[model samples]
Target: MQTLTGKTALITGAGKGLGKAVALALAAEGLHLGLIGRTQKDLEEVARQAKKANAGIEVHIKVADTGIYAQVKEAVSELVGLLGSVDVLINNAGILKVGSIVELPVEEWQQVIQVNLLGAYYVIHEVFPHMLAQKKGDVINVASTAGLKGAANMSAYGASKAALINLSESLMYEGRKSNIRVTTLNPSTVATDMTVNAKFTDGNVEKVLQPEDLAQLVVYQLKLPQRAFVKEVGLWSTNP
Candidate 1:
């Protein structure tokens, strides 16, 4: 396994759920962190916990709404400057809205697309140059299994994630030449606040996947030697 000790990682949606778990896990592995999210307080808390995990690691936080291009651009630039360089990018920021097509408002549907799909694109667009210049990097797009097939009331969310899956694959092909590994993760029914609030998993989280479970997978994938990489992963809970 390649040690992540001195590398720096920039994670979108780092305020909670899988992002927070991954940040703390990476910090324990000695990676400097740049956490981006809309909430300043949540980001600061994550940063504080991360520093406790690795007293020597540098952890920086920025407030950015990934759905907005200007915020993403400014936040990424400032974080890249603070961390020195971005060795890994976690494009995990996303939103979910549930309603049937006829029942779903047009604006709400577009909002989901803007946040879940365009948001990831903006982050990658800004971060890819840094990775390309370095000739190596890892990019993880935290999509959802909802993209694989459609569900009754999840049209907007599914469409957004499906687009993200396609985007991640294209980037994976293009990045291979530069030694940058791009992996798309499609996880089903994680017990995050999003899922619980959406009522996707009845709050009986122990029976389904958890944020830390996905975080462990993220760590494993990133730890693989640079000579090899996993292109995509679809994770499901056996018990669920």
Candidate 2:
């Protein structure tokens, strides 16, 4: 297995859910972290947890809305400067809006797309150059299974994720020449706080996939030798 020790990782939405879990997992593996989120408090808490996970690992936090191009550009540049390098990137920042076409407001629908699709694009646009210069990097884009099919009351969220999947595919092809490994992950109904609070998942959280489970998967993928990488993966709960 490859060692992640001393490498730097930039994770979006690192304040909570799968992002938070992955941050801690990577810290445990001895990777320096650059955490990005909109909430300062949330990012601070996650950074604290990551430090506790590995006292030797460096943790940098930045608050920015990924939907805004200017903010994303500044955040990525500043974090990269602080962390020295970005060997890994987790584009896990996203928002979900559940409503029919007519029921969901136009602004809300646009917001979802802005944050999920365009936001990822903005971050990748900024980070790709650094990875290219380094000639090596790993990127994991966290999509959702809802993108694979249309469903009732999931128009906005599904559309955003679908776009993300397509974007990730294109990025994978483009980055391979530079040795930048990109993986697109589609997880179904993870038992995250957002899912539970939004009532998106059934009450049986125990039967559903957890944030830490996905975090372990990220760690495993990153541990694989540079010559090999997972192109895409669809993770689902065994019983849910």
Which segments of candidate 1 are over 4 A away from where they belong? none
Q: What is the C-alpha RMSD of each candidate to the true structure, in Å?
A: 0.7, 0.7
User: Candidate 1 overall Cα lDDT vs. reference?
Assistant: 0.94
What 10-residue stretch in candidate 2 is worst by lDDT? 197-206
Q: What is the lDDT of residue 165 in candidate 1?
A: 99
Which lDDT values do the candidates have, in the order given?
0.94, 0.94
Clashes of each: 0, 0
In model 2, the runs with Cα more than 4 Å from the true position are none
Tens-digit lDDT track of model 1 for 142-206: 99999999999999999999999999999999999999999999999888899888887875778
**Each model's TM-score, in the order given?**
0.99, 0.99
